[model samples]
Target: MWPWEHVAVGYIAYSLLSRTVVARRPGVPELFAVLLGSLGPDLIDKPLAWGLGVLPGGYSLGHSVFFAVPLALAAVGVAALAGRGSTGVAFGLSYLLHLPADVYYFVVFGDPPAYGILFWPLVPAAGGSIRGDLLSEALRYFTTFLADVTTPEAVPFLVGEALLLATAAFLLWRDTAARRRGRPEATTR
Candidate 1:
């Protein structure tokens, strides 16, 4: 999945979790935190792989659950101790969601889940060294993704993508409506 897709999924998950678990909507800061978390892995790994050649592929390092789980837990622990538990939850959920999104992306592409990428140093990345500079690589990536999305095989992925977008839009609309009505739920922390 793309970075924006990851953000959408993370936000949707965080929103639903907030509503069900805490009976509250997240504030703007929490939404930002979730977006940051959703892109955290790619922000770290992509440059290293495509630009610096420090890793085998974009799926190494931050993509690893071995790294993410402990890091997210530490964030939660620190946040809890600091009395910012909601921020912690937002970060942790968004960070964790990246892994499954990747898996789902592969599955939708008719490939097996590349679970080995989740262990990094403990397990090898599936691909060889990234070719070309970062700009070229990014262009190729987006172009290929666009091409793929236009195919019949991508119909299910497109459907899922629409649902995610709709969910995010609905949440935003609901929040806006509640705020206009002066509902306390609109101001949840």
Candidate 2:
């Protein structure tokens, strides 16, 4: 899945988890904080190649689990501090959720099958471009499979994304209503 898709799913997982586990203690920003934090490690590669005169792609330090994990943790920690315990926990969870997907994409499919146990030996040795056939296959299979099944597979994902967005919209509406009534987050709930 694309980074954006991961993020879209992450946001929903974050929101649903927030509502159930955190019981609305953490606001939407906290959940979103996690999604953004996880992307930080990979996003740098694009800038390095485009702006700072670096190679386009390789098994660089950024792709290293050592570097990415710590950075992602730091991002979540910062969000937690800024937002509070519930927010931080959600961000931290979301940040962690991105790893398996990243590993699958970068280590498993990104490498050639000929090589034996490369950078990430345990993984399947990821290879092929980001937009390559495998990704398309995975996308089509996953999405199609999801969109089928008695009712729909993508429905959960779609509904999850929509709910997250709806929460944000409600926040906006609440803010507007509050301003009109002269209060914020409204003590009245």
Candidate 3:
């Protein structure tokens, strides 16, 4: 999935979880944490793979449960020490959500389930080097994605994704506006 797709899924999931499970809306810090966590895997692995040629692929260390679990736990632990437990949870949940989102994306596109990508060194990625630097690779991928989404077969999925993103964006905007107004629910930490 693309970065924006990851962010949309993370925001939607976190927003619902925060309201239903925690009985509160997320704060600005928690929102920022979710955004960071949503892109953390790609930010780490993509540079290592596409720019430095260090990793086997763009889904190696950062996408793996081995690294993700420990990292999330450490983040939570540190944040708890700082008296921001919810922020930590938000980051951890968003980070973990990224793996399943990628797997789901692959499956939705008729690719085999990408469960192997979550195993990292244990199973190894279907390693392939992308051409050029990270920016170039991203542009190329985006171009391909645009082409794919233009197809009749992809219309329904595209429309659904667009709507989901729009809703997420609106929710974020509402939350930010509420924060500016100092609303009680939106003023948490």
Candidate with maximal TM-score: 3
Candidate 2 Cα outliers beyond 4 Å, as residue runs: 55-59, 80-83, 105-189
Sorted by TM-score (best first), the order is: 3, 1, 2
TM-score for candidate 3, residues paired by index = 0.91
Pairing residues by index, what is the TM-score of model 1? 0.89
How do the predictions measure up, each by TM-score?
A: 0.89, 0.47, 0.91
- Report the lDDT tens digits of candidate 1 across residue range 94-138: 999998888667877778987887888888874445755777777
State residue 50's C-alpha deviation in candidate 3, in Å: 0.4
Angstrom error at residue 185, model 3? 2.7
- Steric collisions counted per model: 0, 12, 0
lDDT of each: 0.81, 0.50, 0.85
> What are the candidates' C-alpha RMSDs?
2.5, 8.3, 2.5
Off by over 4 Å in 3: 130-132, 186-189
Model 1 scores what on Cα lDDT? Answer: 0.81
| Least well predicted 10-residue stretch by lDDT in candidate 3 | 124-133
In model 3, the clashing pairs are: none
What does the lDDT read for residue 84 in candidate 3? 96
